[model samples]
Target: MQSTPATTTTKYPDKPITVIVPFSAGGGLDLTARSLEKLAPKYLGQPLIVVNKPGGAGAIGWGELAGASPDGYTVGITGIDMLLLPLYGSAKYDYPTALTPIAQVAASPMVLAVQANKPWQTLDDLIKYAKKNPGELKFGHGGVGSFPHLLGEMFGQAASITIEQVPFSGAGEATAALLGGHVQLSFVNPMVVKEHMKNGTVRVLAVTGEQRISDPVLAQVPTFKEQGLDVILTNWYGVAVPKEMPVQVKNKLSEGFKAIITDPEFVKSMSNVGLKVEYLGPQESQTKWLADSQKLTKTLQDTGVLEKIKSQRK
Candidate 1:
């Protein structure tokens, strides 16, 4: 009888993995990628290399990831903006379909805040003032189709108020405009304004999400739903590779990220940066991505943003 040849099982991630971040360095997405870089090695048995490909409102990097080989060596960190980009005719790749979800790592709720000296003390106060003032109140957002812009629009619609929107280059610039009194209010991540809130430079009126954030600094802030406005906006980030990667590679990547997100130290570090740890596996992330994409599409249509985009395209 001939001796049977021995089978060899290949180990996944025998080399460094590249993680593409679609935003500039030092941004939340980049920070998340960096954090994972530190923790992923423990589970993946190899270091993670983060590459920044910032441009076209995250299209450049995402497009690169979507077009990369499905060898599980290249993955990316993406957020809701990836879902909204195609709606605005700005994306080159189909989201959630062009990319395979590995796992969702972190989520942060947007906060509606104003200068500390502003008269509005609660969500009701702001709504009342805006209702009476109409376009008199100026609100700043990161950009035209940014997450904060969408949240501001949704808030305006829910409260039946007309407010002027001032778009800035980024959230940091928007927060600066708010501090300089260039805008009456702004919607931004709590982390962006947490220091200002502590110093009494800014006051958070409410947070946008289904429930209140658990952070000590934001525990007292009410949700939009608590104030009778049915709006939930959360900036979430997840890991994904080019679609059609081998199942074994996909499973390994997912398991590695799940481990990183659940690690005690990693969770604490995320919370310190005002990011809430919320883990969702591959299937769940894909489901949420599709649902959110549909919801945002309807919202843009209802708010006439879709019409504006179409008109601009012509």
Candidate 2:
């Protein structure tokens, strides 16, 4: 009898995996990725390296991720900006088609915040004032095509108010501008303004999620729906690999990330930074990405932003 040759199965991640973050280091997304870096290795059986490739309002880094080899070794942290970038004619690749969703990690609702001394008191007060003084209220946001900017537009449309917008480099800069009174309002993350809230330097009027947030500082802050305005914008973060990644490799990556996002310590760390762990598996992530993209596309179109971007592209 002839002896059969023994076969050995190759591990999906025998080498280090690189997780790209499309934001600058020390930012919320980067911090979240760093947190996962510490936790993923225990489940992945290999080290996870976080690389920051921030530029072009996250278009540069996300485009790189979309174009990377579909071997599952390279993946990235993507957010709502990824969906907005292409609508603005700024992204090099389309999402879900250029990249495969692995899993959603965290989500943070946008807060309609003002300087603590502003005296708006409530979402109704702010809208009433904006209605009386159209375009007098200047709102600061991260940039032109960012989620904050979109939320600002949505707020204005839903409330039938016209307000000016001041675009800054990033949320930190926008928050700084708001603090200095350069802008009266800002749609920022609760975590970004939480410290100020504790010190009574900022007052969050309302959250832009479908439901009220559970954060202690924001527990009293009602949602737009609760305030009688139909607006919901959640900034979500997720992991995605290049399109066409092998099924087994995708499953392995998804499993590792699901474990990391749901781990108690990991969840606590993310919460400390104002991010809530909202894990969505591959199918759910993809579905949400597509749905959000469609919704935002219609918003841009209805608001004339899509037309403006198209004309600019020409």
Candidate 3:
């Protein structure tokens, strides 16, 4: 049985608690971590400090967390790429076993976008074009094994077409490349690309969710399944700490995050930036993570990306 993390009864954190981000300062993860820093201190009784350790698709920061003291003073933000990177050969981190989940903060479904000038207006149009052109159609993502990159693989299978993938260092760069016509298409998080979409820089072909967002601005955008494609992928964000943290500290961290995640003001602030608040504490969050990771790993295996990993494990 998995050992449960104990709630922190003894007040830790004589000084500031640090929240490490595995990406640059202006990315979505960095921005959300900063937003949480603004509110987390009130519930945890210690001011939160955000430290960026960007590199290796998040291996550097995650590696630092793995080596840090498990005293609940250090926790960090990880997303879908945390699970996909290993399979894609980007990193060797075993996220499922390395970090203990505290809570899930928010989730934004991926959007299949095309340059505004592209002739493809719908997913079907893009699919047809991809089938006709084979590997001519290109798409951009943050990195080789990032969520968007693997998501593009799933998309190729679901749409039964071929596409060339171009990887960037981060979403901001990927968005810029898409806008600059470096890539004709991209699978981006709606929250990150909402402004560009609204400004007419890119056209949203479909959102990877079952229902459209409540935002009036996305009312006309259809879902991928609605357009006859089968896929549901989201850029999920959450808080996690070193696996060996004491139960008391773990629960305190979980409870503190739960409080902030459900707060109206916190939710509004995150939503204002296009991140819809979705809270799942510890056990629930872990289950979701495991399930999603399993699905993603399975997709990788079936798609041949997991071939080397499987052989090594065997």
Q: After superposition, how far is residue 17 of candidate 1 from its true place, in Å?
A: 2.5
Where model 2 places Cα greater than 4 Å from the true spot, the runs are: 1-12, 311-314
lDDT for residue 159 in candidate 3, whole number 0-100: 86
Clashing pairs in 1: none
Which portions of model 3 show Cα errors greater than 4 Å? 1-10, 88-90, 308-314
Tens digits of per-residue lDDT for model 3, 1-314 = 44546766544755688999987766678878987988876888778999998776677887788677899889899888787766555555577788889999998788888888889888888888889899998889776667777778778888888888787777777888888999988887777677877898788888887788777667689988888777777778999999999888888788888998898889989987778889888999899988988888787877765664346445
Total clashing residue pairs per candidate? 0, 0, 6
lDDT of 2 by residue, 3-36 (tens): 5465597667878999898876755678778889
Where does model 1 exceed 4 Å of error?
A: 1-12, 25-27, 312-314
Weakest 10 consecutive residues of candidate 1 by summed lDDT: 1-10
Give per-model CA RMSD. 4.6, 4.3, 5.6
lDDT of each: 0.85, 0.85, 0.81
